[model samples]
Structure formats: C-alpha cells, structure tokens
Target chain A: MAIDRSHIGVVSEPREIDVEKGQLRFFAKATGEINPVYFDEEAARAAGHPTIPAPPTFLFSLQLGAPAKRGDIFDPENGIGVDVRRILHGEQRFTYHRPIYAGDRMTLTTTTTDIYDKKGGALEFITQKTQGVNAAGQLCVEMQVVTVVRNG
Target chain B: MVSPVQYVDTAALAVGDRLPDHAMGPLNRGTLALFAGASNDHVPLHIDSDFAKAAGMPDVFGHGMLSMAYLAQMITHWVPQERLRTWNVRFMAITPLYATVICRGEVTEIFTDNGERLARLSIGSWIDDATQTLGGEAIIALD
Candidate 1:
C-alpha cells in the first residue's frame, strides 16, 4: 500500500515537556559532548545561560517525549500506514531562533506537511514540521523531519 | 570525551574554508544502545539484531539522529550552542554497525544581514572513508 496522502496536513496535539538537567546531561554524555555548560551550573551561568543549555540535538530527543506513546508517524496507528520495518530516516533539519536551557518548560506541536512517493511508489516520503515553543510562547526551534519508507 | 570549547570566529572564516572535521566512532552495539536509551528512540532496527536481520538488514544500524548529533557536536564545538541559526542533513545511506564515520563541513558562503555575520556550512558524514552516508547544510551566526 502507498502512503496515506489524506493524512497530509494532519496536526498532533501539543506535547508539553519540562527540560530536565539530568536528562540533558545524559544526552550530552551519550552523544560524547564534553561541554561544561551541559554539566556544570556555574559554568552555564558564567556562559550566560540560566542553567544547562541543551545541546543542539537535545530538542530532537525531547520531541520523542510527545504525549503520544508512538512518536514516529509510520507507527501502526498513526494513519499513515507505512510499516515500521520499511522506514528509513530521509532528512532532518532544524532552524534555531534561540537557545533552550534546562529547567525550561516547553510545548511541541507536530504537523504533517507533505507526502509523496517515487520509483513507482516503491519508496514513499513523508515530510513533517515540528515547532518548539518556550514557556513564554516564544518560537525556539523549527524542525523539518522527513521519513522514507520502502515498499517492496 | 570532550574537546576544549573553541568558538569559531567569523573573522577567521572565508568562503571555501574547511572547518575541523569530527571523527565519530567505529560505532558498536553498546554505543548504539546507550544512544537509544539517552535519546528515547529505541526503534528495534537500531537496537535489535534479530529484528534487523528479519528486515533483511545485516544487523542493527545506527540512528540517523545519532549521525545528526555528530554533526551538531562539530558545530557546537566551533561556536556557542545558541549561535546555531540553522541546521539540515539528508540521510543518504544506512550507517551500519561498527562502521566508523567522520562528520565534516566546509564554509561555503559568508554574508551579513541585519548586523549578524552568518556562515553557511556544507556538511556530510562519510563511512569507511569513502561512502557519503549523509549530506546537508547548516548556518550559524556570529554577532
């Protein structure tokens, strides 16, 4: 089956998350980041951040904490109908308007922007847009994520 | 595990300048599992060898976001994390397990807008020193 084009423009409910220092530290360490600002409070303050500022890809991790248990669009019930076994990440992009710090509470909203296929529908591409907003309702990051599913 | 934090000076950059490349791992299962746990992306294809083999893949693979994180590490090391104005990448091929990949970028363009000096970086990840697994661009601002 081809991807569900009717699902295009579908938007998910807002997912609210509180940025945690320990989580940030874990992410930093896992990704091999040795920046003090991610581990030391005083260093982060000295660097002019309120607390530990998340590493760039940290927000991508936070996005996974979306209220929905299944964050991937191709999950069985997301209505897109792509099998998890065939999906491959296609493209990932982020436009940062400002830094996000630990101890910040933010909301994330994801929307399906477009869906199409190529190679006689053997590969389907789904493009989604996700926005992160700080507690003050400021736009912090705009993430453009694409997933490609192979149908054979 | 951590390199010294060195901010990239726009004054030090010009069109076609090559930024320092970040050599990432001979990625193994342990590293992949740790990343999956930390990132909360425990997709079976990344952590389950059996699932991957069932899917016709040789074994578990690394997450694309993990590759993206490597590129981001390169960017953050060069500038303050907050100065990253834009980032983008395309996952062209699967970066298989235990394969070493280097994340790299070059200064492709430099310009100023609204008093912000910005640099455009052409970026990619290369596997086994030959195959380009991912490709994209990023923009950073130096005020």
Candidate 2:
C-alpha cells in the first residue's frame, strides 16, 4: 500500500516510566557491555559519573508503551503488518541532555513527526519528547527515535 | 574473576587522536531481529529481509541504534569501563549489515576543570568495502 506523506503529524500520547537499576543492569548485560560504571556505583563515582550511567540505547526500554493512533503510519489495518518477522530497524539517532542513572523516574510523550514512502517501504519518523526530574529532578534527558516500516 | 579494564587516559589523549580500528559486520537477520526485540523497536526494516528486498534495499540493514550500541562497545574498550559518566550519540546515514564496517573515533578535545575530566570525541562507522555508511560521534565524560 502506498502512503500519503501529508498524513504524518504529531502523535500525542502520554506514557510514564520509572528507571530501575536491575532493569538497567540487565540492558548492560544483554548488550554484552561489562562496564562496572553501569553496575557498581562506587566505580561509577570514582570514574566521574554521579552514579551508574545507563547505556545510550537503554532509553528505549523506558518508553511508556502507549498505543499508536488510528490512521497512523504503522497501524496494521492501515497497511503495515504488526508482525515482528516482517520488520527491520531502518535507522536510529539519539540526542542526550544527560546520562541516565538509576532511580530516575520519567514520563515520555512520543509524536510521529513524519511518514514517507520510499520505493518499496515506508519510513516512520518519531520524536519522543520526554521530561522528568532525576531522583533529585535536577536533570532531564530528551530523545527522538526513527523507525522504518517495510511491506511484509 | 578480575573484570576487564577498558579505559582512556584523557591526560594522554590529544585532539585528532584516532581510536584503533574495530571491525564489525556481515550482520545476520537473527542478530538484527533480536536486537529489535530487545530494544522494543519492532520495526520491519531490520527483521524482514523480504520486506527490505521489496523496498529496493540490497538486503536487510542493522538497527541504527544497534550500530550505535556497537560503537559504544568500542568506547567501553578504550576507556576504563568505570569512568564513563554520560554519553550522547547521533547518526548521519543508513549503515548496511551485509558487509564489514570499520568503526573509528578521534578525540576532538579534552579538558578538565574543578577536578572534573571531560573529553569530546568524534566517532564514525565506515563500510570496509567502501567509505560509505558513515555514522556519528560521541561526547563522553570521565573521572
């Protein structure tokens, strides 16, 4: 199915998350990252981080899991299949305000910024605007992610 | 067991110092798919080889974040695993997984003030077959 570019816009759905140390450590281990800075707080502070720093890609685990809107780009009935086997990661970019540490509770509001059809697939550009204080609410980390959709 | 020590000596680093070349690639569908699942980004572009072929791509590509994650792995190797405070990364273009890509980084600047040490580095991923699929940079903080 061909997609109309104009249909793309902001997807305003609210999602909340609380950062957990164990989960963050799991991410580090899953990625095969053996950084003590991620598991040992003393090592982290000794190394310069205020606390154990979350991996750059670990932010995805914190998404609020809100449902994508109807008439939206990746909606199954709208054309794209929800099947995991049919999809692949097209590209991802991250901009960080600060390194995420354990105990940071945050909320994220993701908006679909753009959707375009290129040759045989669709591109979903999403901007996840997140804002929340750290355990002390002293710092905030904001990020945006882009996903590609292919015809399965 | 003694944990591995992956560290960078900010005092020893200079602007334009390039990291040793690290190679990764010939990516498989399984790795890409699993990465998507683990990352909660189940987009079809990386998992569906058929979908990618239909879309005119040579083949399925790796997750952009996955690539960035791999780059971060390199940083972990260079700097003592314990010193990283925070890091930010960005992507310039799509990197394919069909061929080997050489990931490289250069220290752009290093500075310390008030007992805090910091370094800004420019990192990139280049296709071993060609200088294509150029990636991005990382700003890292250290103790």
Interface root-mean-square deviation, each candidate? 1.4, 4.6
Quantify all predictions' global Cα lDDT against the true fold: 0.84, 0.60
Query: Which predicted model would earn the best DockQ?
Result: 1
Weakest 10 consecutive residues of candidate 1 chain A by summed lDDT: A67-76
lDDT of 1 by residue, B39-110 (tens): 889789999999999999999998999989888888877888777888889899889898887988998988
lDDT value for candidate 1? Answer: 0.84
Q: Please write out the lDDT profile of model 2 over residues A77-97, one tens digit for every residue.
A: 642334444334444455556
lDDT of 2 by residue, B36-116 (tens): 756665666678878878766778887667667667678777875334444445455566776565678888878775677
Error of 1 at B103 (Å): 1.3
Model 1 chain B poorest 10 in a row by lDDT? B1-10
What TM-score number comes out for model 1?
A: 0.94
In model 2, where do residues sit more than 4 Å from their true spots? A1-13, A18-26, A36-53, A64-105, A111-129, A132-138, A145-152, B80-93, B110-118
Please name the candidate that would achieve the greatest lDDT relative to the true structure. Answer: 1
Question: How far does residue A26 in candidate 1 sit from its true spot (Å)?
Answer: 0.8
